[model samples]
Target: MNFTEQALKKPRALLLLGICFLAVVVVLGFFLKNSLISAEDTDVLGDFVVRRSDNATSFFTFVSSIFDPLGTIILSMLAAGIFWLVTRNWRYPGFIFGSVVASAAFTYALKFAFHRSRPPLLDHLVDETDFSFPSGHVTGTSALLFSLAVVLTLRASSRSVRILTWLAAALLVAAVAASRLYLGVHWFTDTAAGALVGTGTVAIMSAILFSQTKQIPAS
Candidate 1:
């Protein structure tokens, strides 16, 4: 079988892929935490992004707020609920809820473990007191939107629809990541690592939780 067919048919392949992604997250986390990748080096892009913003600060601030901890939880539940209602199946909803919770838990645990500080208070556009090695906003947003994109892709009627679903999900996640940098609340590595954590969580969770399930046919 070809690559796509093998990927679809083999849970072992998915599991291996998921493990690979998560291994990268761990290695990246270790490097950042140990100062092997200096914060000053990683913060350069963040500084530039924050400094370049003029009138767009308000817009990015608003975007960041939408994916805060509480916001992420609410959106995850709403998406899970909608998936259940539409599919009349528990697996999709379960996948959504489980992936998000796993992502949030992983992100926060890394933050606590790393104990890295945020940008200077003077640079921050929003008040934030927590450790900032891995941005919680970007992590949670990526997990939720990326999981939804996968589910939607499975149910998409055409190739174009699947492409659009993935594009939209990616844009949303990137916007949230950029918002964290633009708000001066996180370093570039923080957001990048957050994306890795979030995506890794979803990948592993999907392999374990949904790989055995039959694909939802397109409408």
Candidate 2:
């Protein structure tokens, strides 16, 4: 197999890569805890987001709400159901469910461990009560959308279709991450770390699931 095939097909390599990503998130949290990045940096960015136009605020608020906890659960289940209907393979849906749960669990654990506070409440455009080292919204959205992208691309016959699937997923993930910053509920590091955690969780889960199965269905 070529290098790309080896990287994608080897469970060990994928798991190791996923672990490396998670490790980076831990190191980033430590830096933030030590004021290495400085709260002033976040505050400056938060101020900029908070002062944006009302229309921008409205647009982001809508975008962020689509991936709230309830929304995430609903969308994830819907995606899983559709995958099962199309492929008739439990592994695809199982991978989706597993990635979402693992990503959410990991994100919450880090939030409590880091005890990072959100931006000032007065600056917040939406209500958020949790510690915000890694944004739960970004984590959940990234996990779900990226997992879907992986599965869709794997089954897609055309290069353009695969590219489009990945591009769409990436854009949605980016929008969700931006929404957190635009809403003044999370620092830039929070969203960045959340994306890492979510993507890593998907990588690890996909490796585990694919290793158990013979091969993903082509159609």
Best by lDDT: 2
TM-score for each of the candidates: 0.88, 0.91
Model 2: lowest-lDDT 10 consecutive positions: 1-10
Error of 2 at 172 (Å): 0.9
lDDT by residue (tens digit), candidate 2, 141-166: 98998888777777566777777888
lDDT of 1 by residue, 51-109 (tens): 75566887888898898877988888998998888878887787778888888998888
Model 2: residues with Cα > 4 Å off, grouped in runs: 1-7, 36-40
Instruction: Please list all clashing residue pairs in model 1, or write none if there are none.
Output: none
Q: Each prediction's Cα lDDT score?
A: 0.77, 0.82
Give every collision pair in model 2.
none
